[model samples]
Target: MNVVCIGSGYVGSVTGTAFAVLGHPTTVIDIDPSKIDLLNAGKSPIYEPGLDQLVRKYIGKTLFATTSYQPVHEADVVFIGVGTPSKQDGTADLTYIKKAAELIGAYLHPHRFTVVVNKSTVPVGTADLVTAIIEEASGLKAGEHFSVVSNPEFLREGYALEDVFFPDRIVVGSNHERAKNIMRELYHRLVERVSYEEISKDFAFPYNPLTPKAVYFETDVKSAEMIKYASNAFLAVKISYINEVARLCETLGANVLDVARGMGLDSRIGGKFLQVSSGWSGSCFPKDTAEFLQTSRKYGTELSIVKAAIESNRKMHEFVVEKIRRRLKILNGKKIGILGLTFKPNTDDARQTQASVIIQMLLDLGANIRVHDPKGMEMFKAVHPHLHVQYCASAEDVAHQADGIVLLTHWNEYLQLDWKQMLSIMKTPYLLDTRNFLPKKLLIGLGYQYEGLGIGTEQEIDGGIMNQFSVLSV
Candidate 1:
């Protein structure tokens, strides 16, 4: 199949490249010339693990990129993977998706029946909206020359390529049987790829070939859109739920990691997204949850659980800030080192990162912030150019002359630091593991005061019942 993915951002580039690897003649379109140049030169503009290798292998073979929609009519399957960024009112701005639909419709070959897939994470009823736009632009009747399908993407940021070939479920939302049939055929190879032991070993983590293959859910357009929002919002709620537990654990002297592990052992509750982090922040969860709540309100209802999750998520950063303030008497003139900047590790996406919010709060309180990240610094600078921050070369550079160090993102490089040596250079040996991602015993043994979220603070003892322990003695 000749496939074209519009908007070569993270989703578009990864989806288009994966199709090209699946033996389809794929073309990725973007408005940015720099992204196109990078794609043509066998390089990915965004930082994703295993993406560069695939791009390099297929750049001139079956994968191509351009800034033009002139050749889009040649594609049998067109995926609209553009971004629906969040607006000020927390609703998704669909300007890009609308423009892409019109562009595809205007240039699309009227005689050929093409399946236009809504690969972007759009609000419900977007398929109908896209169908209307396409019909208007093409001057053709719907279901005659083209078909629109709401096949939302479920690929995570760091694991996008792997998720593409081995998804948990493949959803195709279409009212038209013809569009559904074409999508099934297009995804047939992926379904087959998951079952083969050799291919599964190469792709699946831990080489689990016995893993169940991805299931397909054929639904109407609206439900498919809801599925995407509901999945992300539920995961966000899970993360916030554990963070709330972690907060109680901080007072009652219970280790959240153990608590999470015990809860996850039950088959009813899986062990994903239960980590006691500062909070959940990224491209998807915040935007999707907001949009989900907005959609509910539009119909004269509200998602109370999702609303609490958002509130809890926002308060998490404030909680961390208060923890730091309590440890150090005043924030004025305090030099703090931040360990990571990106929302999560292994990608350059700093959108809605908790670190930025925390750092901004610290800056407002007159604290000098020095930061270090293995891969996210340049992208962070580009994203938050107005925010003044000192970017360091390495972990030790961040630690130099700092009053305290806060682990924001759990990057692997931050995990392997020589904390004993790094602490010696700092003005004070205070280590705050906001994600609880570091070793607590090792840091304390190094003669440094260590703190972690929901890992039982110094004030709490070993029981749900509390005993007298000083928070300052750690």
Candidate 2:
């Protein structure tokens, strides 16, 4: 099958590459010539664990990246994997998705049947909107020559390639039987190939002797799209709920780790995203939660709990900043060292990262900042160059000439650092572990004043400092 993927970004690149690896002739289109050139040269524009090898294997053979749209007319199936960024009103901005549809339609040859899949995360009813735009642009009626399907992606940054190859479920949202069959065929290779050895080789780990084979679920188009939104929104809510509990744990002298462990053991309440941290921030969670809230509102239903979750997550970051402000008394002239900048570890994606927000807030308060990230420094420098911040080679370099330290992102390197030695170089031995990735006892024993999201001494917990005084109905 000839497949064309619009927007060779995180989603497009990964999804397109997956299809190409499955023996389909795939071409990824993007307006960014440099990104196209990089992919053509077997250099992945993004940092994914197994993407470079995947690109290298299939770049010229079955997968091709280009800035041209001519392939849109040539392909049997076209996947629109562009970004639908959040607007100020919290609604998804569908400009990019619409443009991709428009381009696909305008260049498409008439009388040729094509399946248009919404590979990007879009609001409900967007598939209809895409169909309308394409119909208008191509001068073709829907279902006659082309059909639209809402096939949203559910990929994680660090584990995108693996997720695609071994998806838990494959949702193909289309009312057209032909379109659905086309999608099924496209993903049939994944369904047929059941190889535990391949999975173990991919992770470079021994096979779990007790683990079961992977399973894939197939569902209708609407349900599939809803699954993507609901899944992300629920995870966002889970993270926010844990953070809120962590705040109370800080006052009650209850360790959040223990609380999470107890809560996780309950079969109904599985432990995932239950770790108490500053908040959930990345490209997906924040935007998807907001979009889900807006989508609920549009459907005449108020998802008050989800809305609160979004607000709570935002406040968590501010709470961390406040902790710094309270301890330092004033941020002016204070040289603060930030341990990490990316939204998460393993991948250098800073989109909507809590650290970015916190750093901006600190800088606004007249704090001179020194930042170090394992892999996100290059990306961060591009977004925040005007700020009075120095990018350092190592965490130790960032600690030098710093009055205090903030562990924003829990990178592996940050977790492995000699905290005592790093603290000794700082002007002040103060550490704010927003992510709760550090050991509280070790830091305090080392003579450093340590603070975490929801951790403190027994006196601090019993003093009602961290407890939420007003209890709400659960």
Candidate 3:
């Protein structure tokens, strides 16, 4: 199949590259020449683990990048993986998606019978909207010349390659039976796990592939679009639920790690999103949840659970800020060091990160911030240039002369840092592990005061329930 994915952001870039690796003639199209130039030069404009290798291997051959929509007509499947960023009122701004549809329409060959896939996360009725736009632009009859299919992407940023290549379920929705079958044909080889070894040999596939093979799910256009929103919002709620519990555990002198582990053991409650952290702020959760909620209101309905999740997610940020406040007492002129700036690790995406909100709160209280990240610093600075912050070179640089340090993002490099040495350089050794990620015993043994969310803090032996347990202050 000849595949063309519009918009070379995370979704388009990963999706287009994956299809190209499957021996399809794939071209990634974007308006930005810089991104196209970068892709053609064998470099991914955005950071996704194992994506560059595939791009490099196939750039000059099966995989290609361009700033043109000329391939739309020649393509068997054209995935519109453009970004629909959140508007100020939290509705998705479909400017890019609309523009992409317009371009696709202008260049769509009326007789090709192409399957125009909505790979971007759009609202319920967006398929009809896309169908209308493409029909108007191309003067083509719907269901005859071209059909829009809602095949929303379910990729996680750090695990884009894994999710794409080994998805748990591939939900495709369209009314047209031929379009559905073609969509199935588009991923038939992958779903059947054909040539799985040859295609994935060079790529560093994400560690955990729980499902043996991908489930090919079929549904209507609107349900498919809603699946993307519902999935993310539920995951956001799950994360918020655990983080909220983690705060309670801190007071009750219970370890949230144990609580989460115990809860995860139950088949009903999975262990995936149970891990505690600063809050659920990443490329998808914040924007998607807000947009999803706004969508409910627009239709004169309510998603109360999703709304609570958003509020709870906001409180999770405040929870971390409060942790900092209680430990340091005063925030003014404090030399605060931040370990990670990205929303999550292993990607350069700093969009809607909890770190920024927490840092801004600190800055408002007069805390001088110094930060370092393995990969996210540049993007963070670029995203929030107005916020005055000292961008340090490394973890050591961030630690130097710092009063209190917070581990916001759990990057692997931050874990391997010389905590003993970092502790030595600190003016005040107040180490806050927001992710419960660092070595608590080592840091505490080294005489630096260590703190982690939901981990039992320094408290006296309170003999109440599970045996007489003496929990030392960590």
Alpha carbon lDDT of residue 320, candidate 3?
A: 88
- Flag regions of model 1 displaced more than 4 Å: 194-208, 458-474
lDDT tens digits, residues 184-271, model 2? 7877776665454553454422345354333545566678778889989889889999999988887788778778878999989998
Q: Please, what is the TM-score per model?
A: 0.94, 0.91, 0.95
lDDT of each: 0.86, 0.82, 0.87
lDDT string for model 3 (1-474, tens) is 999999899999999998888888999999999999999999998899988888888997999989989988799999998888888999999999898988899998876789999999998999999999999999998899999999989898988998898888999999999999899888988887677766757778533334588889999999999999999999999999999999899989888888888899999997889989989898788889999999899888989999999998889889888888898999999999998988888898987798899999999999999999888888888889988999998788888889999989888776567777887889999988888776665567787788888887763212212121123212
Query: TM-score-based ranking, best first?
Result: 3, 1, 2
Candidate whose TM-score is highest: 3
Q: Report RMSD (Å) for each prediction in the order shown.
A: 4.4, 6.1, 4.1
> Tens digit of lDDT per residue, candidate 1, span 163-228?
887789999999888888889988887777634454333342444455578898899989998899
Q: Which regions of candidate 3 are displaced past 4 Å?
A: 206-211, 459-474
